[model samples]
Target chain A: MSKQVHRTLSESQVTAISEELNEPDWLRELRLDALQSLDELEFPDVIQTPGRTWTDLSKLDFEALVDPEGALEQKERVAPEGVEVLSFAEALEAHESLVREHFGSVVDPQENYLTALQTALFTTGTVIYVPEGVEAQAATIRTTMAGQSLFNYTLIIAEQSSSVTILERQETADEGDFDERYYSGIVELVAGENSYVQYGSLQDLTENTYNYGLKRADTDTYATANWIDCNVGSRLTKTSVETVLSGEASESQIVGAFYGHDDQHFDVDARVWHENEHTTADLVTRGVIDDEARSVYEGVQDVGRDAWNTSSYQRENTLMLSDESEADASPKLIINNHDTEASHSATVGQVDAEDLFYMKSRGVDEHLAKNMLVSGFFVPVLEEIEVEELREDLNGRIQDRLAQRTA
Target chain B: MAQLEIKNLHAKVNEDGGEEILNGVDLVVNSGEIHALMGPNGSGKSTTAKVIAGHPAYEVTDGQVLIHLDDEEFGDEEVPEELQTWELLDLEPNERAALGVFLGFQYPAEIEGVTMVNFLRTALNAKLEEREELFEGDESEDDEDDEAGYETSPMEGAADEGEIGVAEFQQLLKEKMEQLDMDEAFAQRYLNAGFSGGEKKQNEVLQAAILEPSVAVLDEIDSGLDIDRLQDVATGINALRDEQGAGILQITHYQRILDYVEPDHVHIMLDGEVVMSGDADLSVKLEEKGYDWVREEVYGTA
Candidate 1:
């Protein structure tokens, strides 16, 4: 077993995981193919300037981080009526055709090294299926990491005219027990024609955890998919939330908020691709970094050549609480067609002293005043969350972080 | 005895302290009196108000602002001796506010995402907490062993132990908004965000009414108000003064607001000093003859 654990991934490990899950021959073949691409593919390019890697993925020791033989513990909330939520192994056994048809359809396994690694060695996953014309309530997936390394995958299929909201939370089981752990997750969402899907994710892993997650959605005609991502923990976190508008008249809104403190590092990227005519995309993200923490946000709004009359707007703002904290943002608008309307803005700033004095003059203490400002800073994006519980949950977590700062 | 006194106050812009803005300024505002400070563009009327409120942009180079708290105004409990006389310049802006000093800004900052309800509640509760702590400390010093007995008893010193719950605060806000003829939805909106100039001034008046400060400083609160809104805001300010016996320091370049809210005393400020002081008719005189007359009267050349 020790000899089999080499720097480069072994095919036998891939076959072994697939066999352990009793996956079909096609899935086994896909895993082997993805394992082969790991050697050729490079980590996702995070830095645009040459000779500078803002978030260096090569520094991550994948050999020590990827445990192909790690145990998988899957726990999920009871599915809402007309909604079917199952683990990957259970889904492959009961709904093999549906699982095979939609899995990897939105996010290609060979997209990058991380994706390939996730595809080949994913230990635990969730599959949520909303039937046609069904308006299902929210389903929850709670992941608690208890091991040194864990890979997670989630696939959601909103059938025609169906709608569903999914809230996924990721955190460590014990506070400091899992001192050094690695987490990689992939979420693929497929929204059918006229369907709606809202995906809300809150990640509060322990400070010792290093996390990498990618969530992407594909929307059909008149379909809508909204993504709300809140990141507040982890020693180093790199997440990308993207949406592809593949159907005409479809809309996608990506709202993200993050609060980084201590020495944590957060690299957040949100993107939307307008692939069809008359599609609309709105991306808004707000974050606060304090202490010695650092955050970098990149937002991209791309209007393809054939996507006429595409309306895309992206805005990202990062508020720095401490002078020692650092933040940078880059919002890009790429319009390939002349008929598209697109705008992008990014701003990095500290709390406005005038606004602070204004509140303080009203008798609000300085500490509470700062907390209120930080809380209000996130309101623009928090208001975009369609789920009431999720919005309140995010607000509570923000308050907790502010309290920690005061403490 | 309950008054706000500024004695030979000297202040300057905090950045570099280039020149004194308020030089040897002395003024006294007693409870139940309205004093209008009229001045020209560069005469430092607004700077006085900001300095009194401990705005960080202004540095108080000399002199002191003393605030005397009225025991009956806070509650039936006796005010602590130490809490009675507060040095405004030594305290933070919020501390000054807690001691019943309110400054109505000329250009109120538009704070996005902070709802009017939330902001008002927090401010009001802070003041109440200050009162509660002072009263509690006073009562404990008088009766230490019986302190535990008063813990569960009805709070005669404060409204529910210095904290107003959401429903009660909303109700209070609604009542105050109605009194000011403000739209009910204004309470739910972000604090001063996207508000028209008149709306912003009216909101400031509403905040003053809610907080019920002992000395309310109005710095060009009537600048952007229309005739109707000016009358309404002036009416609200008058009501606050009448109901709470609050001292009013109305600072403006024009005497228009003085027409609606009558002032007992009017002072002309020129070159950062109170050059001339007179009765209400002084505002009418300045309105008709302009500041040239006051400038000539004080400087002997205009």
Candidate 2:
């Protein structure tokens, strides 16, 4: 048998990954350019900022990051027959011109270091395209890491008048050393006029693994995008949900839930920009932190100049169970125009002592009481989920996390 | 037999003005009796109930709250010296609830995430735990470990069974709502959210019937109810004493509710203390004779 392969995020690795998928030249160039820029771009000072934390990203070993090539090679798990779940290189070779035209055009690289690096060197990811006026049930991508940094991507384009839901999940089943394993990914969604796109991400990396990712979407006139993010893992993680309503009468609703335990550090930053008239957006993030874990939530809703009659609201609430657990939330609204209604509310607190006491007084143990409060914390978001199976899965994952923390 | 007693309860609110709300109010409520406290607004009727329920806003300056359960009296006196504050404040609203004290809030707090079902289960479990400690004593709790190799004792099993199941609990809510002339569908709604005045009062009565507190303090339970809703609430409260044998403390400003509920004992409260008390007729007498008689009798001037 051949030796087990270990891969790093390097120039040749990107080339090899692209070649493995037989990608075209332009796509390969994009990967190389992204890799080269990764070395030059400085990771932003996320910590010094009001809500950001200075997590030690330098300690992460990119050299030992395993590729898990076979992880995304399966055809049976193909996300819809028409959609492609291949590496960036494969997309370049098979649909070069298509990838080039739509890849970095939606999200600019100069926006941030993470966005630029993600735009260039995203080796293993998927591309989904729903042709004009043809609505598909959903496009799903499941990536499994066998002890490695399994960075994935999902690029969805809902053509004029079409609608699609994209569900991406990251999980691992490796018995190998997990202390050094990590995953970072980015997904971009572009919905054309009169189109509807709903994107959901479920993260369940190993307890020792660290995950950082970003999700950004842009909606055209008369279009809508709904984002539902459920994060239930990672020792240290940061995610950003960004949206730009560029088309008139466009709207977006972003909702998410993050449950963490132990020494987990989970950060959720949501940004919504209204650039057109009559556009509206709302974001609601609910989270639960237990044990020694910590959660940070920062949300910004901005109504751009001349984007009149735009209305936006954002709310973030977190429940901290244990004394050591900490939660921080900052919600800011910026309106450049006067004819806009922009509002935000944030609350960071512990479980209701009276509620806890009420449950305990009924003979429920302390552990069960905590679980009930946790369940209550997530019930609002879970009820908002349209899909029943996915909702059930999220509920199960939340319960599992609670069990691990109490255990 | 369970009995809750209050003696010379003196309490105050640390407002900017240093107002003393309850000034040496004395009363005795046996195991099964309905006591109606009537007076105008700000007459210290609600303060008395809040002090007994351990509300932090009110400080009990001097008083002894004795709770008798199964022939044994447990209060601040029986508790250890190290546990004085624990026996009082640390016990929490739920702990007091487990010990058979329930407050039907004059204004119920609206909580977003907690559902009525889950909230009830938690409270039921706490009450069961307190009941277990009361029955098993030390030897019985220790025997649980020896027998099952688990922490749960025999009393726990019976408590578990005695506690209503989910379906049965839903049915109970339905029955109680129907008895109160409320819509059965209201059970699924959030507790106390968007409730009108009469609805809130009726909801309190419904909770009292369901929880069956040893001492039920209905603080201003008649302030906002229409005539029909008032009658329904009164009927539901009367069932609490007639069926479940729970002691009731009906705190109200107007005697309108007493006309329907008919208190066994009626007490008149002045600035911060009870000035006069008598049988059911005192409620009508207070309405007819008014505060003039109370002022003349208690303060020696009308």
Candidate 3:
């Protein structure tokens, strides 16, 4: 067999990004290893039926060069007392061993093709560490991704009996001249025993960009992990979010929302594992698509054989604004233990004609009434979001999209 | 005086295998009068209300429902002293609503995610816009109105160019709720979502109070309502007619609600057309003897 440079990112460029991150030698080698794995790893597995697939990842070309020194612009925020919010570079400077212990610990580097690409080429990241028994209100991180190709990584660690809320938002740089671009994001959340971790994220990329994101958390005994992820933009987006209830009596809730328009496509997958006894989970997702846009959703609630007395439920609802738009969903529940209680449901439909007439009969304009219902469609998931500012932002982003469509 | 004239109206539910519902029904609701159109199932009473409101479900096959909107006082000018007569069939439902037409639903749509406050506020803005009362862009700031107790044309106040100010809207909604003896919590809930049967009926009346339409066609607002709720809703309807001086067309299957509301005229509908018309005694006789008398009296049957 002939040896060819099948990978787009090289060892030298991976090393360059690592050096820019101020990492140690071992971490640099890990980046290089991730770069080598990029060729072997494939895109995340997408569901397919006889007639069609939700998102055609095969058409996604990786021919764009990975910028060695991409835009890493993050607004600096001060951490609350007893909490540490530091850039990865600063984390290495002050808490070197802490970063080494937790980095790449929760998320696998070779989990998928995009994960490997982000693992190898990511230059900007942050670590939020809360020790035992610390109670923090909420911290916000806002950043902009620019250039031809960009990658982002985030690590959140909450210790025993501690509680913290992190709300992070990433937006596309509007002034950039890049015609077609790619964005990859990976998030790892660690929840210790009796702890509570809420991570809320919003991604509003440019329509010329493609986005791939994966967020997963591991829960300990009596620990709670909640994820609120919203996707608002991008030409194409495929996100996989997961939670593992590894400890007995652990719990998790994953709430998601997405709004697509102008030929945008989104494939969202959410999964929860009841690995131990007495664990519970709830997966709720709602989204809307319009103007030839499309969306696909897959949710899984797996109750292992030892998951006795567990409870898991899943629900997904989609609303379409335009007749040309389409949506599909698949919700699955695999209950191995007879003692467990589980249910799954999915519904895809257009905006209710009766609802529109009701509002209009009361004197709301047709366009405005449709926009109101669309805005209201996001409320259930927005209420599930822990951070008020993030919820408001997502709501505003939805309105903006609706306004553009109305125009 | 404003008027709503349903002139030899004809309509059909084309989607339901093209079944013609309203067959040349004629009725005229003058300002400050209450008329009840009573019918059994499929008598086309509710369809009249929907047709008056220009509901999209039914198509207007022929005839015209006209709305007479009078001129109003605007500063030094009597804007368009000549009354404008609009054909309801030509107008959208919202446009008809803007011209002081209201239709109270029998089963109000339970729209989740839209709070009562938001829906009411949007409706109020539409009303204001129709009357050219919207605070012009870059005109008076809402702060001034709030400081002076939210006074602006006695209507939905201006928020930010083309919107009613929040404080003024709250003040208006509060006054209407209090007038209707409604709980303050109703403003925060999704529009009619999870509402009890009676609550949904009351909400319809409350919306009518807010919109202050010149002509209100209430369809089965009394159904599923207990006597007490029926009385409360009837009292609210009476208040709207007496205060706003609006004409009302009350559509009902049972005479239970008419007992409280007191219709000036009672019309019995058979098949798709009104066959007989009378005063309050006629309704009482129908309630006492049942609709078999009407079927027999009108068509010489039973």
Candidate 4:
């Protein structure tokens, strides 16, 4: 076999990033190992029919997207009492032991090619930890990407019986001089026994940016984890949100909403594993694609053999606003336990003509009627959002996208 | 001059040059009159109503729907005209609605995500926009008119010139719901989604009450309604007529609803055309003899 030359990044760059952060030797070694794995791993494989690959991730040019020396600027809000929100550097300085113990535990460094790239090159991130039995209102992290390649990470850990909500927003600064950029965001959440954690993420990068995001959570006994993810901007977005109900009676809910327009593309995947008895998981995702945009969604609910009496449900619906727009969805259920209850449904369709005409007949103009129907299509998923500000922000973004298209 | 006039109307399904459904139908509904259009299934009664409302599905092959507005009621110093005539056939459905033409659908489309309150408020605001010339001057004038109980313009007190405030719209919707004996919770529900037949019919009536259109075409609004809901909807329609002097073209398959709301004129249609026209007793005769009698009377054979 011939050896392919695939090292757009070098060991020295990885060492430089780790050294710049003044990380411990173990963390630096992990980054170096992840950097080495990038050459061997390939972009995530997408579904392929007889003649066509649905999402061609290999088409992305990683060489043009690598900038190991890019700067990272993040603005974080102060978390409430009983909650500790710190940057990666600050966390390492103040709570090194705790950060070393929990960081990269939920999301392994060798998860995938994109995750390995993120692990090796991420320049900005935050660590949020909630004390035992404490209830914290919120911790907010906002990032603005401006350079050619930017990688960000977020880690959230809720101790036993503790509860916390985290809101992370990713945006692109209005710097028109930059070339087509790339973004990779990695998020890991760990909820301890009887703990609660809610994570809401919104990514609104510019059209010239390609976004790759992987978010995963681990739920302990009687713990609950909820995720609300909204993606509206990007030239192309490939994202996955997942959870593992590792302990008995643990629960998780994943809610996702996205809007794509103007030749943009999105490939979203969500998965949940009921590994213990009586675990429950619900996954709901709704999106709208307009213009020549395209989207693909895959949801997987896996019930393990020991996951008896488990309840898992998944539903994904995509609304197409234009005839040229396209969407494909696959919702799958893998049940290994006879006592488990699992259901999954996926539908891809255009705006209901009857619904549009009904509203128009009542004097809502054509554009407004279409907008209303599109907005309404997202209600089922939006209602799953437990945070008020996040829900409103997502709603406003959807409305803005609709207005931009019609305008 | 305030009337809805349909003259030798011809229409067809809009798709693929579909076959004609309404063939040379003529009707005139004047203000303050309730006209009952009685017909069997597929007699084009609903088609006529949809065509008048400018539903996009039915193309008007050749027709003229003229809406004549009373200049004293609609005109202001802007144009200073005594009467206004609009060719509704050229207008879009929403434009027709803005011109005070409301169509209560036989099977009201269930808008899954839009609440009844939002839909009604938007429709009411559009209706108000159509009458912007009526309240063109200032807010003080509106206040004075409100103090005088808005006897001059009942709808003016319901909406502002641009957009109705949310609280004001809620209040207006509540009042209309009360008038129709509808539950206040209905406002929060999706428009017509999962609603019972009676509830859908009552919701249509509630929309009419809120919009206060000059002319309302109720297409089989009483079809699925029970006796009590039929009476409530009838009373609501009567209230619209009495309060706004609105002309109603009530289409029905049976004479059940006419018992609650008397019609001044009853027209029996068959084969896409009106075969017989008479007073309210005509409905009773039709109920007793069935539409076959009208077919026989008009064609000289059963």
Residue-by-residue lDDT tens digits, candidate 3, A303-336: 9889999999999999988988988899988988
lDDT of 2 by residue, B41-134 (tens): 8889888887777776777778766655543323322533332222333355556776667787777654444555445534454455555554
DockQ comparison, 3 vs 4, better candidate:
3
Please give, as one word, the docking class of candidate 3: acceptable
After the best TM-score superposition of candidate 4, give how far the Cα of residue B207 lies from its true spot, in angstroms. 0.8
Residue pairs with colliding backbones in model 3 are B158-B165, B159-B163, B159-B164, B159-B165
Question: Candidate 4 lDDT, tens digit per residue, A318-397?
Answer: 99888899888888899999998788999999877767666767776666677667767777777777777777778778
Q: Which candidate is the best by lDDT?
A: 1
The candidate scoring highest on DockQ is: 3
In order of appearance, the predictions have TM-scores of: 0.93, 0.84, 0.92, 0.92
**Cα deviation of A3, candidate 3, in Å:** 15
Model 1 clashing residue pairs (backbone): none
On the 0 to 100 scale, the lDDT of residue A264 in model 1 is: 95
Candidate 2 chain A, run of 10 with poorest lDDT: A1-10
Score residue A302 of candidate 4 by CA lDDT. Answer: 93
Give me candidate 4's interface root-mean-square deviation: 9.9
Which DockQ values do the candidates obtain, in the order shown? 0.38, 0.23, 0.38, 0.33
Give the local distance difference test score of model 2.
Answer: 0.70
Q: Just chain B of model 2: what TM-score? A: 0.81
Where does candidate 4 chain B have its weakest 10-residue lDDT segment?
B146-155
Better of 2 and 4 by lDDT: 4
| Best-first order by DockQ | 3, 1, 4, 2
Top-down lDDT ranking: 1, 4, 3, 2
